[model samples]
Target: MITLSESGVIEKIEQCSNLDSIASLEFYSGILAPAMVNAHAHLELSHLGGVVPPQCGFSKFAQCISKSRNLFSEDECHNAMDFYDSKMWDDGICAVGDISNGSGSFETKRASKINYHTFLELFGLKSCDKTRLNKLSVVASELGLSNSLTAHSTYSLNCKDFDDIVQSNVEGILSIHFMESEGERVLYDGFGELHSWYVECGMHIDFDKYDSPVDRVISTIPSSRRVLLIHNTVLLESEINSLKGHFGDNLTFVLCPRSNLNITGEKPNFRLFSESGCRIALGTDSMASNSSLSLIEEMKEIEGVPLATQLKWATECGAEALGVGDQYGRIEIGRRCGLVLLESVDLIEMKLTSLTSCRRII
Candidate 1:
C-alpha cells in the first residue's frame, strides 16, 4: 500500500505480508504514479479532424485547415472541446498549457475539472502591432484568465510583430510552434519549399526583412520567462547547441510525435536533446492534427528509446517545462495528488497499449 499526500508527495509505501493479509486494508490496485503535465495543445482546433490530411505535407495540410475553419459551428466547436477535455482526463492529465486563438473557449475551459492556463495566440504578417496587442489584453482581462500573452512561432510572425509581442512581457507561460515541418525551415532560411508556397499564397516575401528567423526572435524575447517550443521536428543539433548559452533554465522543448508524424511524417532528434541536457516535454496537440489527447499515446509513438526515458518526457520533463515541476511532476510528498495507474504488462506490450485504455488512476 502507498499513501500519496495531498501535495502529490509519496508519504509511505507499505508492503503487506501477502494479498490475503492485506484484505482488511483499503487499497487501490494497478500502478500508482504521478499525474501528467501536457506542455502544448491547441484545444480550439479540435473540430477539424478528418477535414485535414491523413498523409499530406505540412504546407498542404495547413492550407486544408485554413479552408475548413469556417465550416465548423459554435456548438460543434464546444462539443469538440468537451470531447478533448474528457480524453485528457481519461489519460490522467491534471494540468495543460492550452493555446487559444481568442476568448471563444474560456467558458468551456473554466467549467472543466482540469487545471488550464491559456496563451492567447497572436500571429499576422502585418497586423500584430500595438493595436492588436491592446485588443488582446482587453479580451484576456475580461475573461479573468490569470496569464495571457501574444504568441508567435519561428516562421509565422515578422520581426516587428515578434518584437512587439515579446516587449509586452506578459505573465505566465510563452509558447510558440517551432521547427515542426520542412516548410518552416525553408521559410526561415529563405530557400525551401515553404518559401515558394508562401509566395504562391500571395503573402509578401521580404528576404532582406531580417536575418534568420530563429536568431531574430530569440534575440528579442525575454529569456527569463518560461518558453515552451513545440514540435521542433526540424531543429538541428547545432541549433540546439546554440540556444544552450541563451536559454538558461526557462526554456523547454515540447515533442508532439503523433502530430509530427500526422503532418510531416517525421520525428525530432530526441537522442540529441537528451544528450545535450535540454529540458524536454510531451504534448498530444489537438484532435485536428492528432487522433486523441493522450500523452501516453504520444509516449508510445516515440521510437528507438527506453521506456523510462519516454516516461520522464510525459511526466517530470513536462512539469518542468510548464514551470510547475516542483508541484505536479512526480510522486513526491507535498506535491499535488495528480497520479496515473497503468496496467501490468511487459515493456513491449506496455508501450503498445499506452495509447488506448491502459489503466489510469488520477
Candidate 2:
C-alpha cells in the first residue's frame, strides 16, 4: 500500500497483506509509475499541428514550417499553446524540456501547472548577434521562467555563433538537435540537399574549419556542462562511443521516435542504444512534426526495448535530463511525484500494447 499527504507528498509505502485490508483503501487496476517527462518539445509550434504533412523528409518539412509557422495570428498561437499545455498535463506529463525561439510560450508557461525548462534556441547560417540571445534570456528570466541559452543544431548555426553559445553557457543544462537527418550527416562533407538549400537561400555556412560535425561538437561544447543530445536518428555507433567516452555520465541521448518517423520515415536504433547502456530519455518533438504530445504515444513507437527500460526513459531518465529529479521522477517518500496509472498493459508479457493509455492518479 502507498499513502500520501493532502498535498500529494508520499508518506509511506508497504506491501499489502491480507490482515491489512481496510474499507477506506482504494485499489487500481494496471501499472502505477511516476509521471512522465517530455525531454524535448516545441510548444510554440503547437499551432501548426496538422499543417505539415507526414513523411515529407526533413528538408521539405523545414520549408513547410518556415511557411506555415506564422500563418496563425498571435492570439491563435497563444490559444494553441494553452490548449496543448493542458493536453500534456492531462496526458500525465509532469515536466518538460521545451524549446523556444522567441518569448511566445513564456506567458503560457508561467501560468502552466507543468514544470518547464525552456531552451532558448539560437540558429542562423550567418553569425548570430550574441546580444539577441542574451536579450531572450533576459525576457525568460523576467518572467520567472527556468531557461538556458542553447544552439539549435550542429548544421543550423555558423561556427562562430555556435562556438560562442557553447563556450559562454557555463551554467544550466544544454540541449542540441544532433544528427536527425541524412542531409545533416552529409552536409559536413559539403555536399548534400541541406548544402544546396543553403546556397539557394544565399546564406554562407562557415563550417569547413572542422573535420566533421561530431568533431565540431566535441571541440566546442565543454565536458563540464550537462548536455542533452536530441534525435540521434542518424548517429553512428563510433560516434556514440566517442560521445560516451568524452561526456561520460554528463550526457543524455533524448529520443523522439514518433516525430522522427513522421517526418523522416526513420527512427533511432533503440537496440543499439540499449546495448550501449547510455543514459536514454524520451521526447515528443512537436505537434508540427507529430500527431500528439503524449509521451505514452511516443513510447508505443519504441521497439526492441524492454518495458521497464522504456518506463525509465519516459520518467526517471527524462527527469534527470531536464534536471528535475528531486520532485518528479520517482515515487519515494516526501516526493509528490504525481502518480500515473497506465491502463491496458500486457501484464503477462510485461509490455505496453497498442491499447495502453495513461491517466494521472495523484
Winner by lDDT: 2
Off by over 4 Å in 1: 4-19, 24-30, 129-144, 205-211, 347-357
lDDT of 2 by residue, 211-295 (tens): 7778888888888889999999989999999998888888999999999999899999999998887899999999999999999
In candidate 1, what are the lDDT values of residues 1-362, reduced to their tens digit? 55766644677767757866654666643455677888888888888877786768887877787788779899999898888887787778877888877666777777776677677777866566456645765766676654467565766676666666776665657788888876776675666767777777777644335555567556777766678888889888878876666776778889998999888889887788777777888998877788888887787777766667777888888877766677777776566747687655354544545423444564
Model 2 lDDT, full chain set = 0.90
Best by TM-score: 2
Per-residue error (Å), model 2, residue 351? 1.2
Model 2, residue 135: distance off in Å is 2.1
TM-score of 2: 0.97
Q: Model 2, which residues run further than 4 Å from truth? A: 18-20, 24-26
Q: Model 1 misses residue 158 by how many Å?
A: 1.3
Candidate 2 at 21: error in angstroms?
3.8
